[model samples]
Target: MTVTETSATALHDDAVRTLEGWRTADAGQDRLRRDYLAHLAGHPDGLFRACLPAHITASALVVDPASGRVLLTLHPKVGIWLQMGGHCEPGDPDLAAAALREATEESGIPDLTLLTADGAPTPVMLDRHQVRCTGKDRPENTHLDVQYVALARPGAEALISEESLDLRWFGYDSLPELTDDSVRALVARARELTR
Candidate 1:
């Protein structure tokens, strides 16, 4: 389905309340807050809006089960190793679907499956971060983040997108050396949820 058509799923009330709290907490970023608010209003069940205090607008963590590794992208703007994800566009009906779309687009992995925290198709952790949304058009684009996790098989080849400078597979245990503390936390949380 088209991106806009896909992002129309309703969000839960708890998710809305969480998003509203973040908007109030980070009022300085008006444009970002407004855009996020608009996104939340559209999906009452999508909780990414509420869990955004962590520095993500939205995210998808792809794990490779065979190798016990995770697919990580070196974000061009943020300059860090992160999952394949971004803002929940108007067309992404829900966070899980959005994560899948991002995995396909960023990693060029076809038919990637999304798993839950419990190693099934379940909801994972919501990680947050702070980001300065740079570039020409988005002056007010600073981000408070919310992250999610998904699982894929090993040996899945990925085509790096412009958003990322590099893509690589890292063992879950060795991830600490390649990424920062926050990302490490995300990985740790994903591992816990998956375990």
Candidate 2:
């Protein structure tokens, strides 16, 4: 199925309504969404345009399954705890798969399931900021995010990578103290979906 069709099938009514509001607010938002879908479908190199006003692209989100606790990476540049995801490289097919792959690579967790493919793409509030890339052949660019959840196996341990200063699990009820408002919003949305 196409990204638009998949998104229509996966998102809940309330989420769809929220998206509609976003669509109405900016005419370009709907076109951007469609363009992103087309880009993901056609680009062999896995590049997409940022929704934000920058020339860079690609991003994702990761979620823990058993306890509904999110494994956040404390980014050294931003110094904020956020999801485990980044640019979709030349190999990634879709955003959801890329998110899962990034989570596993960054967290050292092998058993990650793509929630979006299972008809449950968790809504995530976007965070757009400037940061230098830390990956191999590091390039400076903006990140256009495609965020989603991944169901990690129970009792899995996350091996933090060098990109992150710290890796920790934060309960939904107690997420405020650990991160910024955008991260908290992602956690809240995940909790809403799980419950």
Candidate 3:
């Protein structure tokens, strides 16, 4: 009854197409895009295994349209304020669905939806960052993250999840100063997309 053999293949194919169709001028992102495409071509199970040298992750920046504020979760393992997202699960249909699912689960806002362009979920960003590995023999891992911007329903209540130390919204002009360049870049791109 393992779903990976079939569903995982479809999701991987969809992810490949999504990455191929994304438009970007950033050199680093372009590199990640190429690397992700290569990884998918090389590893049939790349979408599901965190133990792989590199794997696909889907995440999103959740913004409250009425207030112009973005929600961030204080990640317990990483110890930083970040967008709601994580590794793709078996039930996710595609990268965008995985991102939306992560946003809903992490932000506790089930009504969250992607900000679409021409009625399609346009990729807002791609990031590749090293993370401490969970595998028994691996010391580190890489995440090829497909990022998106999702709009949260106004007055939606956010409950702190087990994965987060805290959850809060910050105005665009008033984000915390300690976040890394990737988070800042994601927020900036998300703001531009919303505008």
TM-score of each: 0.67, 0.64, 0.93
Q: lDDT of all the models against the reference?
A: 0.61, 0.56, 0.85
Please rank every candidate by TM-score, starting with the best. 3, 1, 2
TM-score of 2: 0.64
Candidate 2, residues 101-194, lDDT tens digits: the string is: 7788878788777554235543243444455555335555555454566667767788988878988877667663657765676677666655
Candidate 3 residue lDDT tens string, 1-195: 367667888888899999898878888888888888999999877877553778888999999867878999998877888998889886788889999999999998878889887788977888888886474465788888889998988766788889799999998878887578898988888887777
Name the TM-score of candidate 3: 0.93
Off by over 4 Å in 2: 1-61, 117-141, 176-178
* Candidate 3: stretches off by over 4 Å: 133-138
Name every residue pair that clashes in candidate 3. Answer: none
lDDT of 3 at 12: 85
The number of residue pairs in model 2 that clash at the backbone is 0
Best by lDDT: 3
Q: How many pairs of residues collide in model 1?
A: 27
Worst 10 residues of 1 by lDDT: 47-56
